[model samples]
Target: MPASTPRPVGASGPELHDHLTCVAAPATWLSPPDGRLAGGPGGLYVADRRVLSRLVVTLDGAEPEPRDAETLGADRVRFTAARGALAVERVRTVRHDGGTERITMRNDGDGIATVTFEVTAAADLAQISDVKAGDPPPPETPLRDGAVLTGPDGYEVRLEGRTEAALVLAPGDRFTTTLTVRAAPPPVPGFRPAPPDGPPPWARTPLTVRSADPRLDALVAQGVADLGALLLADEGDLYCAAGSPWYLTLFGRDALWAARLALPLGHEPAAGTLRTLARHQGTGHDPVTEEEPGKIPHELRPAYAPGRLPPVYYGSVDATALFVVTLAEAWHWGMPAEEVEALLPAAERALAWLGTFEEFVSYRGSAERLPNQGWKDSSDGIQHLDGTCATPPIALSEVQAYAYQAAMLGADLLEAYGRDGDRHRSWARGLAARFRARFWLEEGYPAIALDGTGAPVDGLASNAGHLLGTGLLDRDEEARVARRLGELNSGWGLRTLTAEAAGYDPLSYHRGSVWPHDTAIAMLGLSRTGHREQAAELARGLIAVAPAFGHRLPELFGGQARRDGAAPVPYPPACRPQAWSAAVSPALVTVLFGLHRDATTGQVSATPLPGFGPMTVTGVRAGGRTLTFTTEDGAPASD
Candidate 1:
């Protein structure tokens, strides 16, 4: 077996773990773990541009030796370091338009200390895509006036404080100064941040969890905080930006899944995400950007490099279907009828897009587009049992499931709202039948996908787990899938691919890593299909590993099995505050309780799983009111 290595999405992007990230939507700051913005993707970025590339501090020309660092919140971090007899503390805070750092130096030695405190800063004005591709432009000297740095194209960074202060401190005395770095960049056309005065979209109706396991509580709290930090506003509505550092932008599939998983929190985020995506829904055929009428975009970037993706790319085959699914799910979670009706046209359009696909929904690759269009969309994401990459015109198994659910849900929404839905229901039936006949393998489990020639790719993968709750499979079929999923478990969580498969690299992006969102999705499906034992087992795995990663799950991790004494290995390039990954925390609460809301009645229900002990969840929103659920020793939950 090859040793696990970090593979960046870009051809030569730097790994992510080397730096600590602080984010406030459009503005993000990445620096060394010690909070110094040295080189290599460490900078203060605003709207997809690296406005400040380097910021380092020194005392008497000697840098402090970093002693400890702590993340206080998604947008704040604190670092402690020492040089000689002087102890240094730096508190960094990130905001949407700028950032701030408060530095304090204290003399611990008996004698007084005198030192020259110098701050060095520079800006590269480089595109984030170029930075991710490991081709950042050389730093440009910014015209300095006092503590501020000004660059070309309306780029300005104000470092407000004494930059070169001579400090004389007596024993036990402290010297403190605050450096506020504010940026003013040329406005990119499409992106915006939520109003600073308003609370985060998720915080409007908060969901709190308490369980017998402290780890579960900690995971939920941390995950919710991370999700709050990733929220971005588009056309006055809020949606979760995909993740920190690299992906602090709108991603259609990622945002949709995050909102859907977090439905337990409230209907606000779902409503916001649906409206935002609908506002950008595809309107014409354009091969360059892959835009087709009614197609939901793959990603929304302020700008992209030449020969790369366009600003509003519509290459995703699943986001369109997911849009309908999320809207319907949100409606079930007590979204107001007026709100649902307002978006009905967009949902209808998305359903029409689904109808354009023949037989089963599938995607064909292009030179300028992604080869695979599903969530596991890496170049080599889809492969055969023999490790050969699946060719395009590929029909992924999970995508078919998403399409089926979307069709059925769209039909339900249409009929409820007095619109004709016969065609949608008919379409869903045909899709389910085709999927059953063509996508299943002789080995008792569904294949990962069907290739260009309509042959089953025959890779035992986590994709099949998605089928369990989608209603495309029968009860027995769902049971078989739930059983097969157990084979993919790495003790910590479900692996993307089974270990017996040929291309099962534990650290590969989508080949064998454990994605928290993926595992949580499987857990939800298992619980829905009456496979409570399997769901509980996977839930326990996630809770057990939460403490190791500080109760904040990353985008993905090594799929290595958990050992009695060893912790789960980190996938170095994984995004820590990824939206979908963070949403897994709320998804866990939903799965453990087998929670659901009835669309017509506006009633919420729960069937808590056994062996989870006592658990209580408060502020769960349904029918426009807050409800609290408590279950003791696996008993039935009451609201």
Candidate 2:
């Protein structure tokens, strides 16, 4: 299948925020507004496929009216509903391979009540891409198992109690029934979930945050919970998946960025992520999946068809560089020297791949490749200022920055690990010089990228903001870039593109949307470049909007200019509880405190900024020790 425009957000109606998503890593369930895994945008999903599409409940042929719903944990929820004289309590639990829903009905009327219950269930083994595009799935096929609805190739929905039953209950009497849905593949090796008690072996270090602002406090709390729930363990290795419902698998870029932002938590997860990705590093040139020797993959599927799309896709140019960058950062943040040493070869390969590039790292995927392979992978993501799509083999300004950072950091790592890296240092210096001369645009901001033909594709985007701390831009260049990015800020956060840009669309995913994680990175950049006031302002705006979206930021939202008293508009189909979005809270805290660690020196320190108010973050694990940040004495303190 060739890269095509993503289908529009069709008749599924407006973006739904009321729904709850319970994820058990690779296995997740998204419920509709009614709290049932029924037809619309809710189902049991595993291995990137929606297994059970329809699971509706009715009492005496009438839909149950939802009264109250609350998520108990990442994998459990409680729902209260009423249908006529019956009151119902539904507890849904998402497990590793399947889900169980227990329903308890109580007669609410004074007299005895007799009612019939019917659960209409179906399974359509539809790919996640199809589901996200609102493509109608094939018709469900009834299976041979009694009360089971299944599709071909083992997509099954099994029921224990009868699907249709009649029960009589006296006033205050209760009746309970449980239906189980096992969503597994056709006996594929290495696809099964790990044991419940013993998940992939990673340190369960607890990190906590608190602030004087209640909203900010709540946001941090929710973010911690979300990150914990989204952690997945595969073959004794734990890593954070991008998000649920659609993306419940390993993504190289998302995982790398998430791990980088999470340095305050610990280095174990970051170390695990590097090892997990290195295990699948490309070793040959396969254009179909964009494999090249030493390149890290863009994404990894749970299972793969041999002749079809490979299980691992190495289309991203940044992920490889990022992998090297993360390894260096993790080493600085206290990952064991031996563990970091083990990954030095992979880092060398990644750097060697970058050396082969003439100007900057570029994607080599053919027409069948993803239209836009950067962080903004949507169809129209990489368009010119005039709204035309940028041609492929594009050298993104940020990728150059990433490459520059990677080279410098890779050189440091090589030196620390007893390898020759003067060449890497020389290469980084030359690349930074090239970037400064080539990427700057006449509009006072950097062009988004150089198109396939080496022509600049102009856009005042947030991409240049990433250059601040990367050492790619000099002090004055960083200041100018920061000032331009500040103008594009919507008060809510930095928009992806300036509103005045020809291709800007507030609702578009990458064109004009405000992504919390993206803005967080830019804010970090601002802090690094001595723009403390601007960084604090952006932090305050993010805190203000946190409450509107349940204190857990979505993947991205509309880039509507912030007003004095208006809320940020939600982008339809934006992934909530996304890994990077969940990580923004901590990333902001990291920038606000100006936290830094030197693994060689074993020193930790902080310089807190204003607008964050008086706050304390305890139990931050870094440098192989628990450190604390407090602002109780009118100034930030560290221990």
Candidate 3:
């Protein structure tokens, strides 16, 4: 079906945010408290589809209750609201304030009399359903007896809804529309639970439905699921965009890498991701359009933009390489070889991108693309001590390795699973051979990457750590890279740009900070290269930080070297327990155990590292069959 056109506005309501959004991205239904979207208080009211005007509510604060109708519950409660009567009062009050609300309540107030209630709408709802539409509403639904409210930024108006004898609330992001005289009615559909259209796809990942502490689990599940929901699935290329609010669209490189870790569990969540992305593989380099032949597109359009949408930009050069990398890796983790083989054309195109997009590499060829490609492609993303960004086509290392590794590994899968024989193997060998000859530096570890003019950046960075992964290096090179990366690894994790670099700033969002996901990547790399000691230490460090700031790890964190007791503080306004970040523990678990699946044999083996504790995963299904494992000492002798 074709997409819905945005509704226009100018009829009712107060000032609203920019209603601009990408048509293909997930639709955000509410006034997103975060900043990923571009509307709200933008001087124009009622331009967006849905508007949250003022929802004024009054509560009964007479004798039996204190002025603070909602008192703190006992038993070391976290909420500031009391139990029983008071709690009911608070829910009712808050619901009234929530427009289009559905709440359950019981009234104990004075017997039916005239009760005055206020429901204000200084503006209008273009769609009434959400913020995506940019249309106007019908004149008959005007608030304040057919009068409109206009003010600075937007408008302001007061209106009234009748207080019926009893009220039944709906259960969605819907507003509260009634007042209760006798008692509150049953919940109507879609009233309290905010619409699910905007949350991430994995927001539905299930934990044990029956838990020891159902209440605690419910809250944890919400946080955990919400954390996953924040993973923006780009439908234009429905790959997971990393995290919510900010990371609200498809990113080719990120989605591929993320799914490499995510797809091991099941096909449902990652399937849409794989199929959609493969559809846009590049064909050839057209510099003006930044299109490279057979190249996979990056940054699927965000649907919630009021302006400034990042459409399916084809600027990213690395995702193509990583795309091949993920497809091959998934095969071992139980991904169907047939499914991956179907995307061979995309892989072919991705490999083609690495060679043709040379001019777009980052300064020093840091595996970066365009001045604003790759994950770190933000305008001011690359920096040194002076906050100066590197020029485009930076080639800061890593890309060559990814290119070679993706080729070799992808070929191995084709030869092994798809029965392509020697030709695939031959292509893989050629790429690896070229990578070793051109990109390697015997003395300065690896020369990071070539600058825009192809100059060497000899900075010691964590970039090589990415090599510890993908089975890219020979044993000796792996050992050397691990030792070099260790120098930049702080106790918490590996720093991105490295402390010894000219632009290293732990506080830099991507430049110097330690992201749990990044660390997880390095941690896996360490284990792969036999750096078990370092891998375990890194794994322990990450798990320790999970509960420190609400058990909600973000995409990345400030890696500022220890200043005082607090260390580098969290980047302001970062989403908590980000999607891939939440995958940290599970992926870290893989690192500690050396979990490998032999698909043809349908067996999963764990060569447990020394520190990994014993655990049991029951009723799990995998290996093209059902099996139970009681693991101990890192070995899962099947049950």
Candidate 4:
């Protein structure tokens, strides 16, 4: 495929734009507006496998006409439809293992009605990766003995309650039945559930914001709710699953960035995430899995498959550095001193891994391994301005920024804990000096990356925005990059690549899509570098588009410019409750309120931005204490 050719969104898989999602960790239910799951990707999936492929509800052999659908919460939804004079309602609640649906039929006709409520279901037991690759699974003969559905591979889906019933209803009468779908999927060998504790860490330390603009409040509430739903437990520690439908598994980069963005909520999430990744830190080198000593694995899956990634892969170049950055930020956010000390070994290992990159952090691309190993891992993600792909070993601009930040912060942690930190500090200084001389383009902003020939692959992109707060650039250079970001702004959010670039496709995965998390990262960087106006502009863009997507941002959306009444274009296959995208809510609070805690002084500071009007935020955590703050006309005020 050519680099500029746009891959069809969702391809042969089911379309998600018109569907609704209800997710709870390892299990998720995706269905059309109507409650019926009639084949395709709209089914009950558990642990990367589809348990039920076909589930349809009918009255007298006719499907109900959908009338309304409402999402009650992260794990529950209510759908209403009608069949002639009978009004039907279905309430679904999803859990990690399975889901339950309560069906109610109310007759509103003047005359009596005879209705046969029938539910037909079947299981295919298809792997999600195969479905994503457009590969059809072999036909499986499923035996339905009463409400039990038995399929291949020891996959069993049981509808424990009543599913078929014959009823005669009088005028103004109603009938209700609850059907519980339970699945016992083949146990994944390495999968471990987090201990069943109280609510998730974010839920325990609730953060709420109320501002004059109700959209900001709604976006925050929905984002927090979505974040709580994405939390998954591993070895008694909690970390966020990347997203729903496809990426409901451990991803080092996504989990670390999400935890870092969510620091204002509390430090418990960061602590849990750090501990979880530390337990899986790479201890040896394997060419197949790309695991090197002290490196962080890119992602974790149940098992390895041919022509796919390994069970535990370490193909990413930035995750190790992000691991160090996240740990240092967690410490600054008041993660317990003892807790920080316990993870110092892992942080030290990550710093050492960064040291192995002599000049810049670069990845050797191969057909077996990821070609472009930054956050944008797409094959064609790293391209020149002319739409030609950049040959590896590619050194991404943002990876250098992350490495620089990690080295500086790692030194701080080492020094604070009475360890030698001179080496890391000196390394960071050299990185900054080299980055300035080699990465900057004649156009003023940094190049997206350096190609294999050590030539700057110049592409005007949002990647340059990440350099703002990393201290890799001087004040004047930071201002220049911030100004260039405006060219990538699509009126809704920052486009990954500027439209002027040849590879710019509004719906391309990484080339031009507007990822909320990416925009939030730039917002944080802009705010930190004293470009509050630019940060506020990006903040408003995200807030303005939140309502169109039900205030719960998705993984990414089209980079098309926003119109007067039209909503931002949806990328059909994007994950709705993505961890880092949802974490953007708290990130907004951090940027807008200028919330920061001085690690050495143990003092919290707030520098509110103008234009958000009066605002009040409660449940903010700082130095092991809950705080509340109010802003008057965008100026800081005491609670």
Candidate 3, residues 101-197, lDDT tens digits: the string is 2222333333332222333333343332232233344332334443434432332333334422233223221223442211111232211111224
Instruction: Assess every candidate by TM-score.
Output: 0.95, 0.92, 0.69, 0.95
lDDT by residue (1-639, candidate 2, tens digit) is 012423233212334455688877777888765687656667777766676777778988888899998878667888899987799998998877778888899998999999998787777777776777677876764422356554555555554555667988999999888877776556565333232244422235455567778987787777766776677765676678888766777889999898888778788668878988888888999977799999998887755322134667887879988999999988988888999999999999999989988667777886465777789777778888889989888888889988999999999889987898889888888887787788888878788988898888897998887787998988888889988888778888889988877888887878888999889989998998899888888888888889888787888887888887777777657777798988887787687777888677978788888756677887678766887788763386656
Query: Which ten contiguous residues of candidate 3 have the minimum total lDDT?
Result: 70-79
Could you say which candidate leads in lDDT? Answer: 4
* Per-residue lDDT over 164-249 for candidate 1, one digit per residue giving the tens place of the 0 to 100 score: 78989999999888777777765655644442345674575567788889998889888888888888887778788898777888
Question: Considering lDDT, which of the candidate structures 3 and 4 is the better prediction for this target?
Answer: 4
- For model 2, the stretches where C-alpha displacement exceeds 4 angstroms are 1-18, 141-151, 154-157, 161-165, 189-205, 304-309
Clashes in each model (backbone N, CA, C under 3 Å)?
Answer: 0, 0, 83, 0
TM-score of 3: 0.69
> What TM-score does candidate 2 get on C-alpha atoms?
0.92
Instruction: Please give the ranking of all candidate structures by TM-score, highest first, separated by commas.
Output: 4, 1, 2, 3
Residue 628, candidate 2: Cα error in Å is: 3.3
Q: Which stretch of 10 consecutive residues in model 2 shows the poorest summed lDDT?
A: 1-10
lDDT of 4 by residue, 1-639 (tens): 224545555333445766788988878888988878666667788777777677788999999899999999888999999999999999999888888888899999999999898877767777887866668764643424346665556666776666688999999999998777777765557644332245676576578898888999999988888778778887667788898888888899999999999888888778888898898898987888888889988888875222278778889989999999999999999999999999999999999999988898999435457788899888888889999999889999999999999999899899899998889989999998888899999998999999889999888998998887987888999999999999999989999998888988888889899999999999999999999999999999999999988888988888989889978887777888899999999999999888989998877788999988989888888668888889886687565
Error of 4 at 395 (Å): 0.5
